[model samples]
Target: MNNPVMEQSTPRNVSRRGLITGTGSLLGSAALGGRALAATPRHGRAAAPGAAPRDASIADGAQVPALVIGSGYGGCVAALRLAEAGVDVQLVEMGMAWDTPGADGEIFANTTDPDQRSYWLRTRTKQPISNFLGFPIDRDIARYTGILDAEDFSGITVYQGRGVGGGSLVNGGMAVTPRRENFGAILPTVNSAEMYGTYYPRANTALGVAAIDPDWFETTECYQYARVGRRHAQRSGFPFVFVPDVYDWAYMKQEAAGAVPKSALAGEILYGNNHGKKSLQKTYLPRIRATGKVTVSPLHKVTTVRPASGGGYTVTLEQLDTGGATTATKEVTADRVFFAAGSVGTSKLLVALRASGALPRLNEEIGKGWGDNGNVMCGRANHLWDPTGSLQSSIPTAGIDNWAAGGAFAEVAPLPTGIETFASFYLSITRNPHRAEFSWNSGAGRVELNWQTAWKRESIDMAKSIFDKINAKEGTIYRTDLFGTYKIWGDHLTYHPLGGAVLGKATDNYGRLHGHPGLYVIDGALIPGNTSVNPFVTITALAERNIEKIIATDL
Candidate 1:
């Protein structure tokens, strides 16, 4: 455990020296267990060797037991676990380090003067909305080709994060352990005692997840919002549950020190919590790095992975910055690698690699069975209610778990993005279609997601039922008809996307691509089907479970 003094003294700033070495394993392997060892700082920086005159432009091979791609939830979890197990693990993140590159690592913050504009985008565009969301992709189309039109962009709910922490760095930070049943659904093969009792606790603690502060529950915007629904449920009681969140209690304490009086409560979390929120970058990865065996290399984009001569993997990478000049291309070798670059990232990379004949032995299920978990936005009303000026700081502190009763499950959370307060409920109900297809378009360099519409009536019927109940109640001045009014009958925008590379009776439950032994797929791509709820926690827990199995077999 890290002492408070050490935690406090650790600088939040990013060091340009790039990689730091320390002595401690990720997994709890006794083989390398010892006092944490810190490597002496190398004062002079070395320009990437690939940039110089080299026959083949690849980074000199540095051997490690495990190499994790993408520092998102799954990759971070895998890196931490393997490092603790005495494995020499290296983590490569495509995104740049946070804070310096501004929000999404797209621009620099200090480039614009304080008198003019603090960020580059503010000066570059006429409207804030247009510059931020409107620009389509010219360069780096793989990640940033604005898919949504102006009107649809406003209506279209999309989420993407690029930084040391990945999506967890900029998400709403609401953390809820999946209902034990939902957690069990994916792990039909794994036993309950091991799955729920052990790994669940480990993940929760690692995440520093907790129920919303009881005081906040009473005073926060959530209470006022919940009151609208409670009045309706009073007539015919339907239990609503308060879900847990990943908001950082300590960061909240620190912000309280400066005391800024804003209408919002917990700093508009959806647009990136500038104050205090429990993002993965701020939470787990730091702790994982403290173990010393793991080194995180940011601004590193992995393009290809090939089976090496010694029965390991040789990963081809590109250094985004070397002496202010980007390198040609670099490669590194690792005994094992975990691909946890979220659903879209993993699927695209795998599909492209297979198309390139880099890893042809990858399972036939490379890009198949992709579903977005039928998402709907519905709201309730309380008579005589006027919450116009009330602070809608916290995002999604309350929810109804009634979708399970109607073949699907719906989880509702507050949407406080200054978009619309009337939308008291942003609900996503699960839709289990028999099959869906995923295909990658190389010309466009994007993955196309298509889902067969089944259980359509059930989906609308469920949304209408929830909406009607809320409106019927008194003292509520608003109504929700996101489905009927919005014409979002087809595919609704969802924050949670699952199933591009799916798990099944065919592939290993742990997501080791069917025929490929050492290559693994441990992100959202492995969910057997729609999780019927937010699948981030499920993804993290499943990764933890999978890493445990990997250790049992490999270590």
Candidate 2:
């Protein structure tokens, strides 16, 4: 259904509860006034005063002042910032426009009782951990409006969020910014001093990030798993540190006190949080909608982007129904286009367009230098004395940072099923240098990422160094039953896929595509290989830096 662009009318600096009310309208409207575009041929025609684009028609398709693809971190930030600069902006997302409740009166499904709303476009459920003790834990479900999208490549399966808010919807809310020392290596061309001093802080404030309450964290069941990881790491003589998150600390306290329906305490991650977690839908998106100059279109996927004969560019869109089937094809024109479709999403489009001769001027570096962010998941078999609580919390607050020595940041993740299992699960982020490329496969009519399953060995080795030290200290062994019967390494997939269309290679220093003047790539696609952290903060920061430049010169 094509939704209306609704008014914001919420309080200034609204609470997350405000999202509960505006979310429906947010999706229905999509972005700002996200509705059907005008079909009139748009060539050098100025928008009539009070004539919304959704209300007018161009001869060929819709004509927009600026168009942003993907409502993820980069897109949302771009939309909000541009609108704030008095520019008309429209955002198109290829996923569900959330906000409507299902028959069960819930906005989303839980990680435990996964339903049709658990996954995106998949007949079977894909919980990150596919097995328990060599037994497959996956289930078949009717494909519907799920949140988490397990985008499968030839070699690796990437778990990303699919919806209006993008990664913010399904992630664990770990809003990590890369260390200042690592900025030079990650972005290569960006100025480190300016980013660390200005943009990073701007991104953090905009994200509403906050550290866990030290007192509550020390006592709550939510962090017992983290504490266990810390103890193990400390015993092994490794450094441990707290990780900040976008979740509301006050709300989390209420959940732990039984004052509210438990979300984090109820083992809700990967799917979505019913409350507390400050996903982008609860933050940037709402602000963008309030701007009045921004509009959003959800369930609309941008298929192609090429420079128009006159000026600006023409964008093709495929609209998908609730069943994830294409319902309609559309065309739109924009004076300026920004690509914020995450790393894989943007790379797929750029690589395909270049191969198809849609935008042959694109640089040869469009789909190169992609990595898994050194991500590895493993579970440790703990002894009877080291019982890692049955009633665990899903929100991780602490991590074992042996990055200086082992190049690893191990967050003590949880298997919170309300059952006492003597196992400790951890997801470590290491510095894996293995990079790959994405190329268009004409035979398959799709983009193929040339990442090898074996490339994650460097990450695995880094992770093993720390775990091995902990295992020696605690007399523990690796759990062979978690991933598969005898399988141990969770290297075939990654939750963090970095690179593809790297900064300073595929695009200019400030994310302006090298060959396409008005086209910009502003997502993880801009990062070379890895951010050495959770990446959302870095993505938001780089966008802030680049968009500021774009506004000053291009606008």
- Per-prediction CA RMSD (Å): 15.2, 13.0
lDDT of 2 by residue, 1-555 (tens): 011212122244323433332232223222211223222122223422221132221223988889999988999889988999999987888776666555554566667766667788888877667665455667777777578889888789998888788888888888787777777778777889899899999999989999988887778766676778888888777888888899888988888889998888877787877777888877787688677888777778888898888799999888777788887888889999999999999999999989999889998999999988889988776666776776787777778887777788887788776665666888889899889999988887888988888888888888887887777777666665456655677877888877888888898888998887899998888887788878889989999999999999999
Clashes of 2: 13
Off by over 4 Å in 1: 1-61, 101-158, 220-222, 233-236, 249-266, 321-327, 379-389, 407-412, 415-423, 442-446, 452-458, 473-491
Worst 10 residues of 2 by lDDT: 1-10
- How many pairs in model 1 have backbone atoms within 3 A of each other, for residues 3 or more apart or on separate chains, i.e. clashes? 17
lDDT of 1 by residue, 1-555 (tens): 011111111123212110010001011011111223222112123322111111112244777678888878888888888888888777777655544222322221111111111111122211111111112111111112111111112223334555556677545566666666665665566666776787767877877777767675565443565545444544434457777667755445334444642212533443344445666755676667677777777657788888888888888887664222345577788888788877767877887888777888876788776555556544432222434223344545556556566444445444333322333444646555534545667797755555434434456555545444443433232231223221323234556656778866325877788766788887877875567666667678878888888888967
Question: What is the lDDT of every predicted structure here?
Answer: 0.53, 0.77
